[model samples]
Target: MDLLEKKIYIAGHKGMVGSAIWRHLQARGADNLIGSYSNDLDLRDQQSVSDFFERERPDIVINAAAKVGGILANDSFPFEFLMDNLRIQNNLINSSLDQNVERFLFLGSSCVYPKKADQPIKEEYLLTGPLEETNESYAIAKIAGIRACEAIFKNKKKMYTSIMPSNLYGAFDNFDLNSSHVLPAMIRKFHDSKINGNQPVKLWGTGSPLREFLYVDDLADAAIFILDKNSHHPLINVGTGHDIEINKLAKMVQSVVGHEGEIFWDTNKPDGTHRKVMDISKITGMGWEPKVSLIQGITQTYKWYLQNINSLKMVNMYI
Candidate 1:
């Protein structure tokens, strides 16, 4: 089914990735798209999700809602990351299958792979090793979601696809220092450092670990690509297929925000993994690649930060 006029439901419509997907779909002339905030619908309840499916009966489902957080948040709240995420995905996927929804796109993170998995991580190396201790719970939940989609596809040839996106940053990103991911947290930190007379910014770890990031818009476009092509692969990695050191990333964020602050690395903080770079051959082979460069994506995020400074301030209230 074409995106146009198809009833599409974005589970976490208010979040960075979900909001980007909704906007991309609308921009592409997709009508009949639907979404609900947390207040209107609690995804953790089984009956609530079942009733939502009965009422909305959406044609496509994008399972983007989850209790996502940074390493610190995940380490602090393991149960919430595991239980809440499992509840949400289980309810949504099961409900979608019961309704025989034409397509279901479940969004998983790159962290689902084992911590010591081969560099340039491949989808096939999913359970080859151990997960990063800091975020294992969240990763486990996402792995389950990926496997569920794989099961649906292998057993019934259904259009249940999973996309394991690399680090994403763009509009609607949670900027709270406690819960936000590395990119957004860096943006927030640099912005504040500049405002506070360019105070030295203290970052975690020894700044030697490497990581990759993808623009949320590029991810949104990939979602459209998957929906258009109805790719049947169980899982595909979504990323730039490149990486940068944490120190270099800090410098980039500092340059973007015009912060002249001295960088401080506290070696006392644990560097969860040495490096994680995704092999994009699977998705690139499918003829889809990210367009936005890392610097451009960061610039875009900083601009959004400028415009929504007030909301950025209030974001901390949630933590």
Candidate 2:
């Protein structure tokens, strides 16, 4: 199984995580990589997905496409978050199985774990308790995707596996304040405030929640590691196995962006999860570990944000 020569299809090749994987694979000299944008192929359409799989006949498929957002967006559009993600992953997973794809890697978030799961959440705690109300719909959709991949691997004897990553932020991230995740959102807020004469930045929630974040590039490397090893683990967790408080993270981002502004915590808003850290022993034991530290990753992300601020603004407007 020379993956470098196999045709690899990354479903969300244009996203932060998918693009990172594409870049890494290219750097690794993978020849025969394939990808399609939403305009070219709507993953939600079963016939369209099936047709694409039939035509492309990819030897490997990485399911990275999904409807993603922060708590505000998830709370506002639960149905779209749930249905759209379900449709996209379902079409891709089912199509890959039917087409006899050699390898499939499904990517999901740490949100798939229960809201009140033990700190440093482990894989076994998956459906032990209720999910956070704000993103329950999205979590349910991801849970279904993980279960689907597990079922196919167990019953159909396929090489389909799922990796649950902690909160990810890096290049190509969504920086829009209204819909972006906490890390990128903090970067944007700090950068904007820094440029605006160090104006006070308002952040959502009490800044008390604890979270773990992985750089998108590290996640991509983990994906490639799994592919190369042909790991048969039905589900694995990918993260730094470290957690930080929102308030501390805010200060870190503020320092990275050089924003000399006061950060005001909006107690009115909701902190979706009190603590959501992944137990990465499974992946780490398999010779894969995150190389990017939070501060270093944030530094790079802020640099990218600075270079692409105008383009990001246009993207937000279009969205």
Candidate 3:
């Protein structure tokens, strides 16, 4: 199948991951990409989503829409994070199946794995143990999505693929201190402090948790590469297979932002997972490797944050 000629629908095209995928597709001369803002279409509305699928009849669908946030945001709105993501992905998957979409790409997060899963997490380790309490709701929703896609592919012989990516940060990332993820939140906090007389930045937890981050654009490239190669694994993990401690990551962001502030760790706040990195051997063996290094990705993200500081908006999940 010639992907460039296919009508592809990318849900959540305005957000960080979706926007990166859209940009990558455009750069690769894919001109038939389709997306709509929340105002135009509410994915949670089953009738609306069914109608849209019927009307557009896209050849392929990429499920990238979700209600995402850090620990505090997830804890504060667990119901919304769980229900909204469930609704959005369920609607898209059902509608795509009903429309007989040729191929479906469902994007998931590394959090789908168990919180205490073995380090350098592998795809087979999913659901082996409990999830981090803070983001359990969001993780359950994503797990449902992955299972849905897997069932569809196994039973209906459809080409539905789910890609689970590690912590992603890049342009268009949410910098809102309230709901943003660790990387962008760090970037925003450091930058803000640097401008505000380099006030001491207070970070959550003990700064002892370990995390692995992948550049959003690299995730975009991996998704397309998987599709192009016709690798129809039920679920594939994409990451750099590297990890870093929170304290070190914060120090890196501080250096990148040139913030001359003392770092303080708040033990009261939850640290969430202690360490969550991906075992990317599957994707790497499939000939897809992450391109951007952590420091380089952080620098680029900080640069984008600075360039769009004046026009940045609070990134909220679409219902």
Residue lDDT tens for model 1, 90-147 = 9999999999898999999989998888889999999888899999999999999999
Which residue runs of candidate 3 sit more than 4 Å off their true CA positions?
A: 313-319
Better of 1 and 2 by lDDT: 2
Worst 10 residues of 2 by lDDT: 310-319
Q: Which stretches of candidate 1 lie over 4 Å from their true place?
A: 317-319
The best candidate by lDDT is 2
Please list the residue runs of candidate 2 whose C-alpha ends up more than 4 Å from where it truly belongs after superposition: none
Q: Cα miss at 237, model 1 (Å)?
A: 0.6
Model 1 vs truth, CA RMSD: 1.2
